[model samples]
Target chain A: MSRTRVHNFTISLDGFATGEGLSAEQPFGHAGHRLHQWMMATAFGAPIMGLPGGSSGVDNAFAQQHEPGIGAEIMGSRKFGPPGWQDDPNWRGWWGPNPPFHTPTYVLTSRPRSPLEMEGGTTFHFLDAPGAEALKIAQEAASGKDVRIGGGPTMLRDFLAAGLIDHLHVVQVPVLLGRGVRLWDGLEGLEQQYQVETVSTPSGVTHFTFSR
Target chain B: MSRTRVHNFTISLDGFATGEGLSAEQPFGHAGHRLHQWMMATAFGAPIMGLPGGSSGVDNAFAQQHEPGIGAEIMGSRKFGPPGWQDDPNWRGWWGPNPPFHTPTYVLTSRPRSPLEMEGGTTFHFLDAPGAEALKIAQEAASGKDVRIGGGPTMLRDFLAAGLIDHLHVVQVPVLLGRGVRLWDGLEGLEQQYQVETVSTPSGVTHFTFSR
Candidate 1:
């Protein structure tokens, strides 16, 4: 069924899924990048980033599970980096000409901008509408496939707090960042129950499937 | 300079810090109780465990700073859960009745057992020797100050991996069960760059400090 799923979200041990003061220089925090260590080592990560002869094993097996049948992808403006609206235009989305997400993408932002078209069927549409509105557009664009909630913590918190998400898959990586932005913050007053659907991969990358 | 540091240890998002298939309905996982979530929450996660009017703000503050100047403490057999050893007697070396490790602690174990007793202190020792030996006997016990390593994952991994620990504070909480008794799996190639110093907690809890 079509549902909103936050997939492959990694959190630090200090409750931070992402670090504060995020920038292109430090995409994730010092230890934060370590969270994706497993994913990056996977066959899935190698090919997507255009690496040759990737190592295959338990790590690769788990990496293969990351590409969750994405119909559409949604992200925040901050995640796209380069603050402020692009005036000169030439700001070809975050992932260069060929992004990993090969689907329609809706970016939530305040500034109005034209749709960014990229190679590999990836299009970045800047939505000035509220988060809910952006989600709706993405869902429709998904066309029966699942809408992936790509993030920067704040955006995910907004949707999660608003009760707009149908499922969440959190991958907790074993690394400690003394300071950073936490994932569980501001998520108060939401009573939710989730059963661990599956547990695989010992590369320290654990996946929890949650449905409400 | 004794201070408290919050270490964010990574657990799978599946709610299983270790893996599944625990015996005697051990909530953590079969033998997975060896993974110390409780101790991490105790030493660092005071707020998350809902410590009677705990605040995220308080937790976050401690999390940001580096904890300095810690001394000694105690650990029980029950804390480590089921070891792979067969049961035996004459091994009484956990925290004693009113143990004297007000500073920090270190526990040693091979099998589940009762508490220990020492002059002006306590001693609850287990059969699991070599694996937990060097850590059990250290000078920290004589100086009356340093740090202690807990028996569970919190005590061992946090100290060993982060290279923050100066002593081992192991509390082997007494609980019986079968299966899942491998303390240091997946931790073979840590690439650690540190020197091991030995110390001990008064309550028979041994301490091993790794210095860089």
Candidate 2:
């Protein structure tokens, strides 16, 4: 069965998924970009970005898990693009040529846009459907593989509220931004139960996998 | 003389400061309320909340640090209320009667609101100033004591952009909200440095104080 899993999401001490105000110059906002420092240095990141030579130790092991059998991905509008840029429908993503995900990606957006075709196997499909509808589409597209929930706190909140996500992995960095768009803002009544699957990594990146 | 200090702040491994959708019933969101579980058992938390008996060992020591002398507190509008709530001029804060902070607090917002008076010396003053200005007000109100930058991320990002914060103590708990808010988003260009002051806690609360 294809399951919706949220993996390798990094967050700051304050409680923001990504920094507020999306822009090409400042994609993740002020301190928001610091969340990916660990992933950028690992072997997993090297191959993904087409870089040469990277460490394959514990860091690499954790990084490898980020991209497994991910057949499809879902992200919020903020993670997709700026407001006006979406109108063109040609602008794919912040990541230029040879994007990360080499698979189908479903973007949750209010505005209507055509499916974006990238260099790799990645296809950005803008979904006007509601949260559950988008998830269903992504799940079907995922085949038997797992569907990754690419984030922007609001999107994740929607999935979490609907009890659609099965697994979650968050990498807590050592920095503190103090403020931004909080991911935990409207998640009060969710009655879900999760347990710590594993806890390793001494470099402050603690990997936690929770299941409903 | 600017001294580096780490005010012990506990966070879940999933990167939630408190819980989602902070309401009077559920101040902390879903599993997020448990983020402060370690602190509540500490001696510092017990005494502050007027609890008679509590753990007095290392947990207490760490918890005591959380109550570091704060001359003033800085928060964003979101931490105070919703978007237009500031227009009222009479709406104080979520904290009724006795607020958490006994000292003065400076709220960062675009629209101006009247000073909110609370019992036990807590007063909310709106500051239209930017990150630097708010820090200046906090520093003055601190009266040589440290000024705490409390929030929801945007406010913290501003202070971090200005390189004002001296120390940061982050406690990593075990839990993942999958998404809510993140702390380190827009902190890329600023050049800052830090050294770990201390790391000792049995309750999984690792204290790290950074200095430039």
Candidate maximizing TM-score: 2
Each model's lDDT comes to 0.52, 0.69
The segments of candidate 1 whose C-alpha lies over 4 angstroms from its true place after superposition are A29-33, A55-62, A65-68, A85-88, A188-191, A197-200, B1-212
lDDT for each residue of candidate 1 in A1-212, tens digit (9 for 90 to 100): 77887877776433456655555566764554566766676777766656666668755664565456779989887667645435547767657788877899888887768888889988988888877888888989998888888876778878877888877766655444545655655553232444334343445444545677
Instruction: Report the C-alpha displacement of residue A84, candidate 2, in angstroms.
Output: 1.9
lDDT of 2 by residue, A1-212 (tens): 88888877877545556765656677777654587777777877766656787777776786777688888999888887765676664687878876788888988877857787888888888888888899888888888888999888888988887778888876656555655666655554342466545454656555556776
Q: Per-residue CA lDDT of candidate 2, range B65-86, in tens?
A: 6456777888878778754575
Candidate 1, residues B1-212, lDDT tens digits: the string is 43222222223221123434533355356534443433333434444343544234422333322233434433334443433323535323332344434332445544435444555443444444433343434324425334344444434553455444543222221122222332333343232443433222222111222333
Candidate with the greatest lDDT versus the true structure: 2
RMSD of 1: 14.5
What does the TM-score come to for chain B in model 2?
0.80
The superposed Cα distance between candidate 1 and the true structure at residue A69, in angstroms, equals: 3.3
